[model samples]
Target: MVNCVVKNWQGEQSGETTLEMPVAKEENAEHIVHRALVRQLHNQRQGTASTKTRAEVRGGGRKPWRQKGTGRARAGSIRSPLWRGGGVIFGPKPKDYNLKMNRKERRLALRTAFISRVEDLIVVENFLDQLTAPKTKEVVNALTRWGIEPEQKVLLIVTDTTPDNLYLSVRNLPNVKLLRHDCLNIYDILYADKIVATSEAITKIQEVYCGE
Candidate 1:
């Protein structure tokens, strides 16, 4: 069991809450974490890098000149990759970068991430109601009052729907990302320097993934 300090809307320490760590299968933890990390990486990739190929580029419908009679090098079409303003050669194309992970692996990864939070002592009190809107200043002030650095990347995990104000306020902050309890990903957990979550989210994770 971990004892964490809860904070109120006024940024004052309210009280303490006790939570039990979920018991997870050690054998599956690593695999789950790996898959979740991979999934997150894949999701982040836009994979929108696209270039026009010879066939897709405009023009080149007719040969530029006679194949062997031209005073210059033999030319097949104007859209050749060697020509300027021509189609790209082996250029990147837009496509899906989504990667599929087994359900068990995903669950395991989430559990492992939670376990790490527990080990790191990063999980803190749920402060969902602390801010009414997406005000970066308010969020920064709250973190400052709690001794959390505003410059560091902070991941806030909410157990349920994050209020519009909370979402709006944190969206513009460079070092902050709003995540739901059920949406906890390994990449976010490991990438962030700190984790701030609501008590409800903590309990949900322990119940669903750790079976505490």
Candidate 2:
């Protein structure tokens, strides 16, 4: 267990919290990479949006020409991919982009990512109290106290439910993102310069990644 000290909105010392560092687990690097890639693919697909294809465009119902009669090649609907303003050829469709990775692989990737973050010294003090609401300045001050820059993008992982105050406080900060224990993602972890998580979240991460 590692001891970390975090401050609250009041600028007072909020005491210490004990967290098990799961990033130190001696897991397979290959497994971790596979899991992280799967997660990246999953996130991309989950938030995907559907866009209309040219073939599905309106005003393409009419045939442009008669077959074998005109000098032009055999023609179909006006929306044919060959024509200008026609439907796109082999364009992206609205489908699931999710990649199915094995459970063990996913766990490994998460572990690997956690290890990488720890190696970078990005993981910091764990918070204990749930602030009444999110306060951007408060979070900023906490980071400043820890010698982290205010402009750094920080990922805060909370155990269980997300506190209302913390959520609201970091919402407006472009560099900061708030995630629940179950919602940790490889991209987010990789993108963040610092990670602030609760003890419960740390434990959950360990169980999921290290099986500890």
Candidate 3:
């Protein structure tokens, strides 16, 4: 359980909120979180890299020099590994990089990672109504008021009910990444220097992750 200060759009402390989630034990917290991170990063790989071997290359049927002394070493095919424009030797082939972890372990890892970043989490009131239109400047100014520097990376957590205006307003800000509460991941949680989450989004996170 942690206490977080809730701020309004004006960056004033309106109230406070409590965050309680089931995190892993300290003994293996790092290990589980590391596993989850590696799994996620590895699973994102396309693994579509492929290279043709000598036998798979085209135009390799006829022997290059008939295996006889023609003032040069005999060559079996033009597509040999040693020849120019030839097939690759021991090259990479398409493969699957997906890694698996139990659902419970994955959740535990996520909870642990999220909790570890408690110091950087900033809870703010729902300000969807504050933005009447898609204005990037408004979001930027709000971020500045929220104590976030312009250059700092921020992970803005919103709820599914959040309007597209907020999305449009924040999309142009390269330093800010907007994510939904339920779609939260360890990568984004740990990647951002500061996490700006709406009060409603925080509640959704607690409900989904804490199972409350």
Q: Which regions in candidate 2 have their CA more than 4 angstroms from the true location?
A: 1-31, 46-81, 85-88, 119-134, 160-163, 207-209
lDDT of 3 at 72: 90
Candidate 3 lDDT, 1-212, residue by residue in tens: 89999999999999999999989989999999999999999999999999999888889898767666688987888898999989999899999999999988888999999999989999999999999999999999999999999989999998863568988898889999999999988899889999999888888888888762
Question: For each candidate, C-alpha RMSD in Å?
Answer: 3.6, 4.8, 1.2
Error of 3 at 154 (Å): 0.3
Query: Among these predicted structures, which one has the highest lDDT?
Result: 3
Residues 1-212 of candidate 1 have per-residue lDDT tens digits of 67877666555777776766543467867766777788889988999999999999988898788878567989889889999989998889898999988776676666667666754334456566666556778878876776677677888877765468878877888898888777767777888877777667777767766642
Give the per-residue Cα lDDT of candidate 3 at 4.
Answer: 95
lDDT of 2 by residue, 136-207 (tens): 787777767655687777887777444567777778888878888777767877788887776557667666
Model 3 scores worst on lDDT over the 10 consecutive residues at 62-71
Q: What's the lDDT for all of these models?
A: 0.73, 0.65, 0.91
RMSD of 3: 1.2
TM-score of each: 0.74, 0.66, 0.97
Ranking by TM-score: 3, 1, 2
